[model samples]
Target: MNIEDLRDKDLQPQLDELIGSLTRMWATMLDCHRQQRAIIKLVSRSYNLKISFQSESQRQAALLLSVELRNLCSNFQNWMVAQVHETSEEEEEFQETCC
Candidate 1:
C-alpha cells in the first residue's frame, strides 16, 4: 500500500499493540536477566568451592551468554525507542498535512 493509504489514526491501534508487546517483552527480558545473574552467582560459587574444570567452563560460558543477552537487550531498546520517535514524528507530519 502507498503511504497515502496509511493514516496515523488507522495505525494507532496496531502501534499501541506493538508498544504493549515490546513493553512486556522488555519486562520479561529484565526478569530473565535477573535470573541469569542469580544463576551466574550460583555457578561462580560452585566454581570457587572445588575449582573443577567443568564448573569453570560452565561459569565462563554463562558469563559470556549473559553479556551477549544484555547487549542484545540494550540494542533492542535503543532501536525500539528510535522507531517510536520516528513514528511519532511521522504522525505529527501527517496530521499537519491533513489539517
Candidate 2:
C-alpha cells in the first residue's frame, strides 16, 4: 500500500509485526541472561563473594531485567489481541448463519 493509503490502515498487522520483532529481540537477550547467571555461579564457586545490591553493576542488571519484563508485557498484549480477533471472526461467522 502507498504511504497515503497506509496512514488510514488499522493497527492489527502493525501489532502482529511488532510481536514478531519483539520475540526476536527477547531471544537475543536469553544468551546474555545465561552468561550473567554463569558469572554469578562462577564468582560464588571461587570465593566467598558477598552479594550486595549496592553496586553500579547491579543497577545495570536491573535495567536488563526490565527489558525482559517489558517483553513479557508485550507478549501478553499480543496474545490478548489474537484472542479478540479470533472471537470477532467467530462472531462474524455466527452472524452469517442467521441469514
Candidate 3:
C-alpha cells in the first residue's frame, strides 16, 4: 500500500507489542548466557578443588542451570505468542467488502 493509504495509528499498538516481545526475547537470551557462564565457572572451580570428583555445589548449580534454561524456553514461548497479527477494524471491514 501507498504511504497515504497506511494508517500508523492502528499499527502503533501492534508495533509496541512487537518491540516488547523483542525486548523480552533479548533479556531471556542474555539471562541464559549469563547462567551458562555461571555453570562454566562452577565446573572450573570444581576442577580446581582437586580433592575428588564429588562436588555437591557444582551438581546443584548444573541442575539449577537446567531448570533456568527450561524456564527461559517457557518465557520465549510467551514472547512468541505476544506477536500475533493485529489489523484495524476498518481495514478488516474494507477487505471483507472488497471480497
Q: For each candidate, give its TM-score against the true structure.
A: 0.46, 0.42, 0.41
Error of 2 at 54 (Å): 1.2
Worst 10 residues of 1 by lDDT: 44-53
lDDT by residue (tens digit), candidate 3, 3-93: 6446465665676687578667766866775686577557546643434326899878867876886677567555544533222343476
Clashing pairs in 3: none
* RMSD (Å) per prediction: 8.4, 12.6, 10.6
Task: Give the Å error, residue 10, model 1.
Answer: 18
Q: On TM-score, who's better, 1 or 3?
A: 1
Top lDDT: which candidate number?
1
- Candidate 1 structure quality by residue, lDDT tens digits, 1-99: 766457455686786787678667766866775676577557646643543446878979877976886676577657656766776686688679756
Tell me how many residue pairs clash in candidate 3: 0
The C-alpha stretches of model 1 lying farther than 4 A from their native spots are 1-54
In candidate 1, the residue pairs with backbone N, CA or C atoms under 3 Å apart (3 or more residues apart, or in different chains) clash, namely none
* lDDT at residue 45 of model 2 (Cα atoms): 70
